[model samples]
Every structure is written in C-alpha cells, then in structure tokens.
Target chain A: MNDFEYLEPATVAEACAMLKRYGGEARPYAGGAYLSIVMKQGLIRPKALVNIKKIQELKGIRFDPSEGFVIGALATHRELETSQLIREKLPILCAVEREVANIRVRNVGTVGGNLASGEPLTDLAQVFLALDARVAISGPSGDRTIPLEELFVDLYQTSLGEEEILTRVIVPPPPPATGIEYIRFSSSSVVDKPCVGVAVRISLNADRKTCGTVRIALGCVAPRPMRAQGAEALLTGHPLSPQLVEQAAAAAAEECSPISDLRGSERFKRGIVRVLVRRAMAVAYDRASHASTLRLRSGQAGSA
Target chain B: MKKQIRLRVNGMDRTVEVAPRTSLLEAVRDQLGLTGAKLGCDMQVCGACTLLLDGKPVSACSFLAVDADGSELTTIEGLAAGDRLHPLQEAFMDCGALQCGYCTSGFILTAKALLDEQPRPSEEQIKDYLGGNFCRCGCYQEIIQAVKKVAGI
Candidate 1:
C-alpha cells in the first residue's frame, strides 16, 4: 500500500471535518479489509486516511421496542453472526454472515464498510433492503437519514456525499407474519464472490392465503444490487401459486442486467437468478404463512 | 511517516513503529521477528496469515498494524507453554495433519479460535470454520481429524 498520513477522528463530527479538510484527497478507513486491498493494488491513492474506528458513536448493536435494530457502523461481521439479539430476532442475518468470505474476513469486516463500499458482489445491502433498513449519515452539511435502497447509486459507488460518514443502519423490525430469505449462488467454489444473490421478503395477508407485500432484492446482477420490481409487482396482492412464482421468477430474470464473466455467462446468471428467485420467494412465503418467525410489532413496510 | 503503537503480542507487550501502509503481517514477521504467520494470499481470502486479534481470527496480511494498538494479539508462537506444545499443535503432529507446513500455523490458529468458541463443535461446524484456510498439500482430512481430536468429538 502507498504511504499516507493516518488521521484518527474521535467523533462523527470530527471525522466529517477531517474529510472535508482533505476533500477528495482523503478516504474514510474502517475494517481495513476493503481499503487495504484496493490501496495495495494502486487502484486508489489517497493522501490521507481518516481512520474512523475510534469514533465511539459509530459502534454497538442496539434494539428498541419501537426502533427495531440499530447496528453500529463499525460493528464487525463476526459480532453480527454471534449477536444475541440478531440471532434471536434476525436469525437470517446470522446465517448469511456465516457465508460471507471467511472466518478471518468476517472477524474484522464491518457491516457498514461492506455496504458503504458499494461493491456489487456483496451480500448485506440486498438483504438489508429486503428488511427495509435505513442508514444514518453525518457530514459537513448536517445529519441525514435515508433508506438503504437509496444508498447504492452504482458499482463501487454510493449516494453518500464526499464528507459524509455512514454512522448506523436502522432496520425496522419485520412485522408479524413476515418472512425473509436470502439465497447466494457461486459459480465456482463456495467462497467465491456471489454469481447471483436473491433476497426475498414476504408478508402474508390475513387468512394467510394472499401475499400482501413482496420484496425481491437481487445482488451481483447489475451495476448495483437492485430490487426486481417487475417480479415483485407480479406477486404482490396475489395468492402465490406455482405458476405465479414461475412467472415472477422469469420476470426477475428478464429485469436484471447480468454481464458475462468468468463466474458465469450473462445467460447462465439470468438462469440462476430465475431459479434462486423462485426458491427464495417460495421459502420466504412458506415461512410467512407458517408465522415461524413472527415477532409482533407495528411499523409501516419500507417503500420499494 | 512512522507512528508508534503498542500491542500485547503473544502475552508480551511491545511497541512497534510502522507506517500507515504497513500490514500487521509485516510488523509481526519483521519488527517482532515472529515469522510463524505466513504471508500466503496478499488478499484476505486465504488464511495463511491468520492471527487471533482479541481472541478472534483475522487475516494479518490485510489487517492494519496500526489497528492492533491497545489490542491483545496471538501468533502461532504463543500457542505453546514453555516446551509443551498447545493441544492443537500436538494433535496436528499426532494426526500427521501437515505435509508442507506452510498453512499449518494459519489452520492451527483458526482452529484454536473455533475450539475456544465451540468446545465440541459438530463435524459440520468444524468444516465451516476451517473451510477458508487452504491446505494446498490437500491435508484436509487429517487436518479435520487433528481438530476433532483436540475437541474430543
């Protein structure tokens, strides 16, 4: 890695000021996993690294009766994998974290760093989108909160301002009779970057026969992880059936723009997306219908 | 520019001066002269540079040396007490788990972290934790046997 001045900021305000002072010549450094690789490869050369690990405000996992789960930006993947509250409440997150990279990477890679990196071949953003999460940002202008869906603007890019820092992720609790599932596909080894990832969230209508709300978030299939709105529209307010799921899956495949790569061809990725979308939506719906993960709570579903 | 940072490495508190670009693997092998943690994949994917950072396995190759400040770190050299080998190290020897020995330190350290968390992890759990560490010599079956022996599962 190229030599750079390391600046440690003790608070969100301080970090923002430091970034603003350095402007484009500085980058916020956290988790080390993402930045070190890129820096070593000479992909980016920042004159100074504003290390945000010391910012106490950006650390811990908190849950409230009304606020759902608030995850600290600096919290590591391993922490999420073993967090008692996440395990009990959002167990799907724990399952997904287990499959992210390896034990060493997960031990130090932060959730916020993963999302903020906007790396298309990732797991958390789509899953968080399915759970209807929001991000809290601190920057030179002021503090602002935005839905997670708005964060990703493109591959390796986010809507975050130059001086903004993602401080925490707010995950609204899944309402009663809501089920979530994420299926990750790799064309080669299990540890390879995802070829296609599908995250599905479904809420059952009373009488448990119709799908009241549906989210089909996909990753590694476009410039950024995106919602399969066409597929979701086909299923929402409808009683999910084998034929309907097939149609929705096919629709999801059509909506995504996958490019041919070493992992798989564009054609193969669409096929994987179709199969995974069908399976993930089916499983999520089944879970919702069974109410196996129901935790009674009141909150509006996040907009797509 | 160089910055001074203190780390409790293998039970010894020592201060090392490093540049912001210096990785923990370089500091341990060059500054502290603890060469047990091999530098295999410069990227974080391979586990050849695994070190226990505050009791959790992390890739020293990718982890910043500056980040180790005020934290407890364990390298392969710390596993033994005096002349007695750590149980995991002894198990690897008894099971003939290592052929090339390049990835042994990483595997043993990672296994130590796993056994610390889950004393008697099932076979599946064992595989999940150790799956990331590559044994290019293909000593995986024996490596698993060594870990199971230590766990007594």
Candidate 2:
C-alpha cells in the first residue's frame, strides 16, 4: 500500500470538515475490508485515510415495528447477523448476511463499506433495493436520505459525493401479512462468486392465498441491483398459482441484461435468476401464510 | 514515518517504535520475537496470521501495528498455560489435526475464538467459522473433530 496520512477524527463534524478540506484527497475508512484491498491493488491513491471506525454515532442496530430499522454504517456483518431486532423484523437480511465472506471478514466488513464500494455481487444491495431501503449521507451540507434506487449510478459508482460519508441504512419493516426471502446461485459448491441473487417481499391477502403486493429485486445480473417491475406487476393482487409464478419468473429473466463473465455466461445467469426468483417467491409466500395463520390463531385464543 | 506503539500481548505490555506501514504480523514476529503467527499470504486471504484483537480473531497481515495501540492482543503463544496446553491445543494434538503444522497456530486461535463464543457448536457451524482460516493439508475432518472434542459435543 502507498504511504498515506492517517487522521482519527473524534466526531462526525470534524470528519466532515476534514473531508471538505481535503476533498477527493481524503477517503473515510470504515471496516477497511474493500478499501484496504483496493489500496493494496493500487486501484486508488488517496492522500489521506480518515479512520471513522471510532465514531460512536455510526455503530449499532436498532429497530421497531412501528419505526422501522436503523442500521449504523459502521455496524459489522457479524453484528447484523446476530442482531435480535434484525432477526425478528427483517429475517431475510440475516439470511443474506450469513453468506457474506466469512466469520473474520464479517467481523470487520461494515455495511457502509460494502455499499460504498458499490460491488454488483454484494448481497445487501439486492435486499435493500427490494425493500426500498434508504441510504443516509452526512457531509458539510448536513444529512440527507437518498432512496436506494437513486444511490447506485453504475457499476462501482454511487451518488455519494467525494466528501460525503454514508451514515446509516434505514430498512422499513414489511407491511402486515408480508414475507421476504433472498436466494442466490454461486459458481461452485462454495459461494465464491454469486451468479444471480433474487430478493422477494410479498404481502398476502386475508385468506393468505393471494398476493396483495409484491416486490422483486435482482442482483449480479445487472449494472446495478434493480427491481423486476414487470414481474412484480404480474403478481400483485393475483393469486400465486404455479402458472402465474412461472410466468413472473420468465418475465424477470427476460428483463435482466447480464454480461458474460468468468463466473458464467449471460444466458446462464439469466436462467439462474428465473429459477431463483420462483424459489424465493415460493418460500416467501409460505412464510407469509404461516405467519398469518399464527396471528389468527393467537387472536382467537385471546378472544376466548 | 515511524511511530511508537504499545501492544499488550499475552497479558504483557510491550512498547516499540516502527515504520508507519509495518503490519501487526511483522511487529509480532520481527520486533517482539514472537514468531508463532506465520506469514503465509501476507494478505487477508490466508488465515496464517490470525490472532485475537480484543477477543475477536482478525488477520494480522491486514491490520496495522499502530492501530493496535493499547489494545488487548492474544497470539498463539498465549494459548498455553505454562506447562499445560490449552484445551483446543491438547485436542488438536490428540486428534492428529496438524500435518505440516505451518497453519497450526492460526487454526488453533480461530478455533479458540469459536469455542469460546459457542462452546458446543454443531459441525456445520464450526466449518462456517473456520471458512476464513484455510488448511492446505486437507486435515479439516480431523480439525473439525478436534474442535468438537474440546467443545464436548
């Protein structure tokens, strides 16, 4: 790694001031997982590294059924995977969290770093985009919330300014009688590279047999994680029959524009997305129905 | 561009001055003369330089020595209690988990952290935790058994 000045700021205001002073010459350091590797590869040559790991405000996970979930930028994958609130309110996030790197990397890799890097293969991007999560940024201009879809501009690019720091990610709780699932396909038996990843969030009707609303997001098959609007339109307010599920999956596949890479061909990735989307939808529907049944049973017991 | 860094290793504090870019792996082996943590990849990919930073295992190669100032560090040397071996060390020896022993220290430390956190983890969980720590000797079956033995499950 090239020689660079290291600055440890005690507060976010100081950090923002440092960034404003140095501009592109200074980069905020979160977990240092991707940034350190990039530095070693000589991809970037920042004049200074502003270590933000010690900033207390950017750490920890908090959630409420009414208020949604707030994940601090510096919250490591290990913290998210084991967070009781995240597991209870957004279990799909935990499911995807388990597949990221490994225990050691998870301990050091922060959600901010992963999203800031803007890697297409990252799991969080798809889940967040599907759930319509918001990215919170802080800078000299103060804080602002950007919708997840607006955050990603292209591969390895984001809407964040050079002096801006991502502070937190806000994940809204699923609507009542809703379920979510995340599924992905890797190159080998081990998850080295994700060929395709699909995240689905669906709200079921009172009978728990029909879909009232649905959202499908695809990753690893596009320049950025995107919602399968065509497929979502096919399922909303419709009963989830096997025929309809297949049609929705095919629509999702047709909508994706994947590039052929070392991991797999574009055609293969599209096919995987189609299959994974169907599987994710099935799983999500099952979970939603079960949750609805349990709610009804508990309500009946209370009344008696 | 050298700075003075104080590291508390194995319950003993040692202060040393080194170049700014010196990694924790080099400081442990070269400066402190504690060579138990071997340098395999000199990158975070290989877990040969794994050590405990505040009770959590991290790759020493990617960690700067200066970042460890006033931090509690536990290396492979700290595993043994004088004449007695740590439970994981004894279990590894009894289960024949090491062949070349080049990756022994890192594997032991990683396992120590896992066992400490979850005393009775299942086989799958043990494998998942050890995923970052690689073993080229293909003795992973024995290593898993060793961890399981020490975990008493």
Candidate 3:
C-alpha cells in the first residue's frame, strides 16, 4: 500500500472536519477489507486516511418498537450475526450475516463500510434495501437521512458527499403480517461474493388472499443493487397464485441487466435470478400467510 | 509517514513504528520477529494471517497495524504455555494433520478461537469455523480429526 498519513478522529464533527480539510485527498477508513486491497494494488492513492471507527457517534445497535432498529455504522457482520435482538426481531438479517464471506472477514467488516463501498455484490445492501432502510449521514451542514436505495450511484460509487460520513442505518419495523427472505447464489462455500442475490419482502392482506405490499431487490446482476419495481407492482393488490408468481418472476428477470464475470456468464445469472425470484416469492408468501394466521388466532384468544 | 503504536502481542506489550499502510501481519513478522502468522493471500481470502484482535479472529494482512493501537493481540506464538504445546497444536502433531505445515499456524489459531467459544463443537461447526483457512496440502480430513480430538467430540 502507498504511504499516507493516518488520522483518527474521536468524534463525528472532528472526522467531518478532517474530511473537509483533506477534501479528495483523504478517504474515510472503516473496515479496511476493501480499502487495504485496493490501496495495495495502487488503485487509489490518498494523501491521508481518516479513520472513522473511533468516532463515538457511530456505535451500538438499538431497537425501538415505534422507531424501529437503529444500527450503528461501525457494527460488524459478526455482531449482527450473534445479536440476540437482531435474531429475535429480524431473523433474516442474522441468517444472511452468518453466511457473509466466512468468519474472518465478517469479524471486522462493518455494515456501513459495505454500504459506503457501494460494492454491487454486497449482501447487506440488498437485504437492507428490501427492508426499506434509511442511512443517516453527518457533515458540515448537519445530519440528513436518505433511503438506502438512493445511496449507491454506481459500481463502487456512492452518493455520499465528499465531507459527509455515514453515521447509522435506520431500519423500520416490518409491517404486520410480513415475511422477509434473502437468497444468494454462489459457486462454492469459499466464494464470498454472490453472482446473483434476490431479496423478497411480502406482506399479506388481512384475509391472506391478496398481497398488500411486495419488494423484490436483485444484487450482483447490475452495476447497482436495484428494486424490481415492475415485478413488485404486478403483485400488489393481486391474489398471489402460481401463475401470478411465475409472471412476476419473469418480470424480475427481464428487469435486470447482468454482465458476465468470474462468478458466471450473463445468461446464467439471468436464469438464476428467475429461479431465485420464484422460490423467494413463494417462500415469502407462505411465511406471511402463516404469520397472519397465527396473529389472527392470538387475537381471537385474547378476546375470548 | 511513520506512526508509533503500542500493541500487546503474546502477553508482551511492545511499541513499533510503522508506515501508514503497514499491515499487522507485516509488523508482527518483519518488525517483531514473530513469524508464526504467514502471509498467504493478503486479500483477506486466506486465513494464514489470522490473529486474535480483542479475542476475535481477523485477517492481519488486511488489518492495518495502526489500528492495533491499544488492542490486545494473540498470534500463534501466544498459544503455548512455555515448553508445553497448546492442545490444538499437540492434536495436530499427534494426528499428523499437517503435511506442508504452511497453513498450520492459521488453522491452529482459528481452531483455538472456535474451541474457546464452543468447547465441543460438532463436525459441521468445525468445518464452518475453519472454512476460511486453506490447506494446500489437501489434508482436510486429518485436520478435522485433530480439531475433533482436541474438542473431544
């Protein structure tokens, strides 16, 4: 890696000031998994590295019933995997975190770093996008919140301002009677990046006869993780049947533009997306319906 | 630019001056003369450079040495008690688990972390725990046996 000045800021304000002072010459260092590799390969040469891991504002995981789950930017993948609260409230996240890039990388790789890197194959961003999460940013002007979907501008690019630092991620609680699932297709156990990933969030109607809301997001198939809005729109307010699910899956496949890479060819990834979308939607629907039925049973018991 | 940082390695507190981009693996091997951790992939894929940072196994090759400031680090050199070999090391030796010996330190440290967290991990748990470490010798079954023997599972 090229030589650079290492700067550790104790607070968010201090970090922002360093970033503003260094401007483009400084990069915020988070997990350092990606940064170290790129720097070693001479891909990026920064004059200084502003280490944000020490900032006091960017730490901890808290869940509020009204406000939802607030995950500190520096929380590692291992923390999310073993968190009892995350397991209880959002089991899907735990499932994905447990399988991210083996144990060592997950031990230090932070969620905010993953999002900030804007790597298209990242698993958390897709899951967070499906959950309708929002990112909190702090800069000279102050703090602002933006939907997670708007954070990624392109491959390895983010919409974050030059002096802004990603502080935390706010994930709203899933709607009542909702089921969330994220599935990735990788060639081997050792391969961390997925060729294609699909995340589905489905909320069933009161009677479990129609879909109230559906979110289908695809990862690694394009320059950025994107929501399959066409597929989602097709399912909303419509009774989910075998034929309807097939149509939605087809639409999702059509919406994505995948490129051939080391994981697989363009055609193979598109095919994988179609199959995963169908399976994910079906599983999500089954879970949402089951949860709705259980809630109805408990409501009747409470009244009785 | 060079930065001075203090790190506790193998129960000994030592200060080292390193460049801004120096990795923990490089500092331990080149500066401190603790050559237990090998530099394999350096991209965080191979776990040959695994080290215990605050009790969690992380790729020292990718982890910046400057980040080790005020942190407790455990390398393969820290596993044994004086002359006595650590249980994992003894198990590997008795079972003849290592053929090439290049990946031994990484596997031993990783397995130590696993057994510390879970006393009697099942075979599947063992495989999942050490999945990141690559054994170029292809003696995986023997390695598995050694870990299971150490865990008494």
Candidate 4:
C-alpha cells in the first residue's frame, strides 16, 4: 500500500468538499474491505482517502409499512444480518448477508461499499433489483434517487459519477401476496464467490391461481447483475406450475452470458442458474401463498 | 505522511506514529511490539490477522491502523490475566487444539468474540463464527471441542 493523505469529514457536505477539491485523486473510504485489498494488490492507488464512515446520515436501518424499508449505506453486513427490521421486512437480504464471505468481512463490509465496489459476485444488489429498490445518491449538485438496477453499469463499474456517493437504499414494500428468495451456487467453499446467483420475487393475484407480477434477477453470470426479462415474461400473468417453472428456468439460463472462470465453467454456470431459478421460484411461490393466507386472516379478524 | 494514532490496546492506552499506509497488523507488530496477531495472508482470506476492534473481529492485516482511533483493540496477548490463561485459552491447551500454533491465536481470539456474543453457541453457530479462521495444520475437530468445552455445549 502507498502512503496517502487520510481525511476524515464529519458531515456529508464537508466530505463532498474534500472530494471535489481532490478530484480524481480522492476516494470515499467506507468499510475498506474491498479498497484495501485492491490497493494492497497494487491495482489502484488513490492519493487521498476521505473517510465518510463518521457521517451520521449514512448509518441506520428503518422500515415503514407504507414507505417501505430504508437502509443507510454505512450499515455493515453484520448489522443487516442481525437487524430485526431487516429480518422482518426483507428476510431474503438477511439470508444473503449471512452468507457473505465470512464473519470478519461481514463485521466491517458496508452495504454501500458492496454495491459501490461493483463486484459481480455480490448477492445484495441482485436481490435489490428484484425488489425494485432505489438508491439515494448525494453529489456536488444535490441528491438524486435512481432505481438500483440502473446504478450498475458494467464489470467493476457503476453509473455513479466520480463525485457521487450512494448514501441509502430504499426498497418498496412487497405487494400483497409477494414472496422473495435469493439462491446461489458456489463452486468451492461456501464463502467463495458464487458461480451463479438468482433472485426471484413473485406475487400471486387475488385468486392465487395466476402470477400478478414476477421479477427474476441473475448475478455472477454477466458483466453486471441483470434481470432475466425473457424468463420473467414467461411467468407474468400466467399460471405457475412445475412445467412453467422449468420453462422459465431454461429461459433465464439462456438469458445469461457467462464466461469461464476459476469458480466454474461457463456451461456449469448456466446449469447452476437454471437449477437455482427453479428452486427459488418454488420457494417464492410457497411463501407468497402463505402471505396471502395471512392477509386474508388479518382482514377477516379486523372485520369481525 | 506519518500520523499519531491514539487507541487502547488490551486495556492500555498508547499512542503510536505510523506511516499512512501502515495496516493495523503492521502497526501493532512493528511499532507497538505486540506480534501476537500474525500476518498469515496479506489478503483477508485467512483470519491469522484477526483482532477484536470494539468487540468485533476484523482482519488487522487489511484494516488501517489510523481508522481504529478511539477504538478498543484486543489482540491474542490480551487474553491472559497476568499469567492466568483465559478460559478459552485453557480449554484449547487441555484439548491440544493446536499443531503449528500459527493459527491458534487467531482462532482463539475469534472464538473468544463468538462466546462473548453467544455464551452458549450451538455446534453449527460455533462452526459458522470461526469459519473465517483457517487451521493449516487441520486441527479443526480439536478446535471445535475446545470451544464446545468452554461453552459447556
């Protein structure tokens, strides 16, 4: 690692000033999990690091029934894994957080860092995309909100400008009878990056006989995490069954463009995605059915 | 580019001067002369550099020493109470849970944090918590027994 000036800004405005002054040489320091490793490997050398971990605006998890769930970017993976709010509202994300790298990494790696680093093997952003999550970004001009899907641009890259910082993520509440699940297949240890990751969000209509809306997002199979639109289209407004799930899974597998890496071969990745999509859909559908039952019982109790 | 960092290590307050690029592991071992936390892998893969920062296990080899300012740090050397070993340490010794001893300190520190957070962790929880620490000599069963013995599980 090279020697560089370390600056700690107490507020977001101050941090923005420092970043603007330093221009391309300064980097916002979140949880240094990824940046430190890359720097140690001699991949990137920033002349200055503006530590924004102290900024209060970027640190918490809150959930509202009407407004949905809001997560401060500085919230560590450990925080997400243990947060009751996250567990109640977005249990799928909690499951994914529990499996990130290991406990040591989870203790320090922030959600913002995970998304901003633009690592392809990550599970959070993929799941966020499925849930129609939005990110609140702050920059020199002001703040702007964008869907989480659009934030990702390419391999190790994001749509964020050089000066913009992702401060928070807002996930809209799951529609009535909606169920979500994230599943992945790693070639080696559980802590290793996934060869194929799939996230599915499905909501059944009032009759519980057909799909209302469905989303399928794939990760670690492309340059950036992407939605399997072709697969999702197959399930939308159609009755979900074993046959339908198989067809949808095949479509998702074909939608991915994976390259052969150390994790697994390209063909193996497609196969894993196909299998994961099917399993994920089954779990999501079952959960959605339960959710509908719960809603029905609650409504009846209120009426009585 | 040298900066003064003030932090508490093993219940003692100290100030050290380090270069901007110095990692917490380097500062602890080189500047402060506390070499208990070994630098097994510069990367965060192996937990040989595990240290409890504010009661949370972190990889010191990759953590910036200056970032730990105002934080309480505990290394393996902090486990003993003057010549008396901590319960976890005693258990490891009785169970012979070490081979080369290179990964012992890291594993012990990680296990200490785990037991503190969950006094009676299940075997699965124990395995998950200490999964970050790697035992190159393959004393995993012994390590699990040592932790279970300390937890009375």
DockQ winner, 1 or 3: 1
Model 3 over residues A250-272: C-alpha lDDT tens digits? Answer: 99999999998888888888898
Off by over 4 Å in 1: A296-304
The better-scoring model by DockQ among 1 and 4 is 1
Q: DockQ score for model 4, please?
A: 0.81
What tens-digit string does per-residue lDDT give for candidate 1 at B81-149? Answer: 999999999999999999989999999999999999999999999999998899999999999999999
User: What DockQ does each prediction reach against the true complex?
Assistant: 0.89, 0.54, 0.80, 0.81
Candidate 3: pairs in clash = none
Candidate 3 error regions (>4 Å) = A292-304
The DockQ-based CAPRI class assigned to model 1 is high
lDDT of 4 by residue, A1-304 (tens): 8779999999888888888888878889988999999899878899999899999999999975665788899999999989987776677777788778889899999999999898988788788998899998998999999998888999999988777789998988777888778887778877777777788888888887688889999999999999999999999888788999999999999998999989888898898889889988887887788884322111100000
> Candidate 1 lDDT, tens digit per residue, A1-304?
7889899999889999999998878899899889889999999999999999988989899896777799999999989988988887888888788888898888889998999988999788888988989999989899999999899999899999889999999999887789788888888877778888889999888868888889999999999989999999999889999999999999999999999999899999999999998888878887888785455221111111
Regions more than 4 Å wrong, model 2: A64-67, A189-191, A205-209, A293-304, B18-20
TM-score of 1: 0.97
- In terms of lDDT, the poorest run of 10 residues in model 3 chain A is A295-304
Q: Cα deviation in Å at residue A143, candidate 4?
A: 0.6
Off by over 4 Å in 4: A64-66, A293-304
Per-residue alpha-carbon lDDT of model 4 for B2-93, expressed as tens digits?
88999899999999987778999999999889988899988888899999999999999999988998899999999999999999999999
The stretch of ten residues in a row with the least summed lDDT in candidate 4 chain B is B36-45
DockQ-based CAPRI category assigned to the predicted complex of candidate 4: high
> Which candidate has the highest DockQ of all?
1
Q: What is the interface RMSD of each candidate, in Å?
A: 0.8, 1.8, 1.0, 0.9
| Stronger candidate by lDDT (1 vs 3) | 1
Model 3 Cα shift for residue A62 (angstroms)? 0.6
Task: In angstroms, give how far residue A282 of model 4 lies from its true place.
Answer: 0.9
